[model samples]
Target: MNGIILPVDKPAGWTSFDVVAKLRSGLRWRKVGHAGTLDPMATGLLIVLFGECTSSSDEFMDLGKQYRGVVKLGVTTSTDDLDGDIISERPVNWDEVLVRNIVSSFRGEILQRPPAISAIKVNGERSYKIARSGKELSLEPRPVKIHEITVVELSCPFVTIEVTCGKGTYIRSIARDIGELLGCGGSLAKLRRTSIGDYQVEDAWRIEDALRVPEFRGQR
Candidate 1:
């Protein structure tokens, strides 16, 4: 078999690997992998590759991604998202003009530091492991391309935005930086990946459905 590319609408609370494992078990495929990793708190399009397709994971990962997310202002966290412990709180007193201006400033290329509680490797070990061990790791900022960011709405402490970015761009970091620019810390409250390259969540399968599809079931 040449294998297949399966677009999955990954539910929250499941790691990217969890999706791969489920399919591997259900379909009994020897080789299965996911192109990109989404935080457990996030839900969205996850590209699942099987068999020979697994070899092309890097190509899928390098494609641009789109997301819709909500950022909560006035609070910072150990991680850059709601999954982490709260580190601080501040008053959110800002007008829409200021918020919009600052949010728009993140357009184009920018250096962003990955969250400590992330999959990035530090000294051959996952950075999150180091963080969980009660140690601090200084991660350097790297360049990522932000194609576009639109402020969808602003309701007091919550700011909603739609983002299109290149590989390695973290929306959580964008929220964190925006809050810093607004004089109040911010953390990603909610996130949903909408698309990757031409693949959209609209066409993705829920885990259970994918496992039961006639074509996929027949492949086994």
Candidate 2:
């Protein structure tokens, strides 16, 4: 294959690079790249590029994203997700009306602070690295547009939300902010990227299948 655009359903516990590396080694391709980075805890659509497609990464990355996630109210964590240590806890006494209002408040463009344990670079190092060194890491909030945010379900401490947002939007930050507004700390309990632009997870290849069929060519 000269150049191919592969949509992969990235499995949880595997970094985005892991997918590219696996495909690169298995397919015996020299150049391989990914459009976006999904955290180790996140699972869903990850666009993999090959050969000439590698050069068009930014075009794919700039597209909007959609995610379905669960936010745990009244609980805060180090990484803003279940993968981190507990930082704080509080009581939950919020109703559906209040929850809906709070979640929907984030629909428009807003300044969002990226998680400290993110891959974002600070100074000359990764923010997560500085945080791991036991030093304070300050990250400035930047503008991110959330096209839509709907409450899929609200069950006590867990609120399931589906989000459609532009680039640079952090679902973890939305979870944290939602918790804060409800007067209770919160963190992301679950997250799955369902789509990116027109690319859907349903059409993506599973890691196992992709590795098993290296010769399979996908739409570019």
Candidate 3:
């Protein structure tokens, strides 16, 4: 059995499981899996493993990730992203200096709480499952290191950010925390993973294009 590693440009509205299912069908590989999960609302680089490539999954887990995203200030949601139920809306009044200070504060090591709608398992069930049931999911804050975080652009309600961070960092949580720090409710509006470790999104294949590659087609 030949093993192959492919970088995928996952599109929004598709779950990570959806990507795996499509790859399994297109590549005819029952053993296919993804190194990390990307939320349905987010799009970006996904390292797909097939056959013997699955053996190397551990090596891929530690890869640093880069993302570009927009956070909508003055609004809070249950899921910490646009897909969830709205929790509250508050007024936002920030000068450029205040925004810069808040962004800078999150630049290095920080403790962040995972969103309630995350896939993190608690007591053998997904946290999101508990959240959907209308139960409070009390997540503990964990330490995460941000390699770099730059405010790309700032508009009144929407702030664009480019982030490079260690593995396991949740960009959605960052948005939520930033909102708290600025005393304005906020949630992620859009997100895209630009890179994972050495794998750049620019070099990744779209799912359709990946399926058309000779080696992949031959497997089917």
Candidate 4:
């Protein structure tokens, strides 16, 4: 296939590389890549690069992203998401007004620490690798911008929020922070990327259907 940016709706439980590998085999070719990875537990828009397009990652990687997620309050997970082990829990004491106000406070720029089980590198080794080895590291917090955070629903233990933020923002971090702000622990229960700049998940090509249709647009 030639060069093109293909929008794929990544399925949950599949690593970003899994989608790339699936395309590579089904298309009987190589040179496939993806921009802006989603965690294995999150499903949504994944922009894929094909053939010569693999060289254009920077174009999309820096774009702002949007995500809709559910934060499970009163519970803390090692990974900040359901994929990790539950480390602790606390009693919840929050109301809709408090939740809305707390979520709104996250708007604008803020510092966030990426989860230990993340792709971030420390001394050339993935942080997750180090974390899985039973070693603890005080990872530095990085600046990220949250343009907007809208609280969609508030039901005590479950808080749903939609976030519009810059490239480096982690929804899991937002959940954890929100929980901390409310004096209760928190973790991401579900997450889905709705958009990245101009690309929307609604228009994304389904991996299952794409594999069956041989002469897709990416074909040479």
Candidate 5:
């Protein structure tokens, strides 16, 4: 049995589970699993563990991650990203100076509330499942560290940002919290995971490409 580490560039519209399923089938290994979960609307690097490599999943999970994203101000969604129900919309006049200031405030330690429609478990059930059933899910704020946050570009309501943060930090939550700080509601318009610790997206193989490799096909 080979313990190979595969980095996959997950495309949008496919859940993390989808990627794992495809890898499992392609590699013919029932032991394949991913280090972290990325939402269907997001794309980028996913570290996949196969065969005997599954033992290293915890090491990859602890590594920091970097992401680039666009937050669309003036809109608030139930999920904090583009996938969920739109809760409200308001006018936003985002200038470079204003955006810079808001981005600055997010650096260092911060408390963030996870979106109601998230994978967080509450009372032994996923929060999103509870939220989708029309039940109110109240999530407590947790401490998260933002190592760095920079405003990459700005165009009216759309502000692009690059963020590097600790494990388990949610970029969507950062957008929503930043919007609150600026008095304009916001939600993630786009997101891409650029890197995870020392692993860059450039090194990741596409799912289709990984499937064609004979070494991957013989894992089962």
Candidate 6:
């Protein structure tokens, strides 16, 4: 079968691999792969490569991604996002100006610690496995690039930002750090990827749409 690279708009409830599993079951041929993994809480553009397209997956994996997301102050969770258990809370003392300033400061190269419930590996197991076990799990901070971060909206408790970042950037970490700077814990409230490199979510197929009418398919 001829291969093709398909761009999909992954929904919030679906894991990256879930899309692959569904495609494998519903489509002809067998090879299916994704350029990157988006957490279950995230909804965004996911690149699905079939057969020969899978061989070139690395080409798109390093491209920068842009996201529109919300960071809510005064509350924090174990996963640094709303999907996890609330671990702490504090009164928000930040105004719009202060919040925008903090968000702007992150628009460059910075060392960031991946969230505890991340998929990073440690001692042969995913770090999130350790985190779910309620054990101590701390990963070293690594450098990541924030190409640009613009404050889109700010309403004291909720700060909305659009971020364009290089590979390895974590938007959740940005939310957590912003809250810490404001003296109130923060967690990611919402996220949607607008683009990845030249691929836009608007041009991607929704999961349901793909199942019924795939935007791209192989020629057998």
Over 4 Å off in model 6, which ranges?
214-220
Task: Please give, for residues 1-220, the per-residue lDDT of candidate 5 as tens digits.
Answer: 5777899999999999999998898678878888988989999999998878889998998898999999999998889987778889988866688789988888998888888878999989999899999987879998888999999988888889999998778999988977887788899999999999999999999999998888766444
Q: Would you estimate the TM-scores of all the predictions? A: 0.97, 0.96, 0.96, 0.96, 0.96, 0.95
Candidate 6 residue pairs in clash (backbone atoms < 3 Å): none
* RMSD of each predicted structure: 1.2, 2.3, 1.2, 1.5, 1.1, 1.6
For residues 45-101, what per-residue lDDT tens digits would candidate 2 score against the true structure? 999999988999999989999999999999999899989999999999979999999
lDDT of 3 by residue, 18-65 (tens): 998998998788688889889999999999999889899888888889
Q: Candidate 4: where is the Cα deviation over 4 Å?
A: 217-220
Q: 35-108 in candidate 1: lDDT tens per residue?
A: 99988889999999988899999999899999999999999999999889999999998789999999898999
List candidate 3 segments past 4 Å from native.
Answer: 217-220
Write the candidate numbers in order of decreasing lDDT: 1, 2, 4, 3, 5, 6
* Candidate 2 error regions (>4 Å): 217-220
* Model 5: CA > 4 A from native: none
Whole-model Cα lDDT of every candidate shown, in order: 0.92, 0.91, 0.89, 0.90, 0.88, 0.87
- Give the number of the best model, judged by TM-score: 1
Could you tell me which 10 consecutive residues in candidate 6 have the lowest summed lDDT?
Answer: 211-220
Clashing pairs in 4: 1-220
Cα misplacement distance, residue 141 of candidate 2 (Å): 0.6
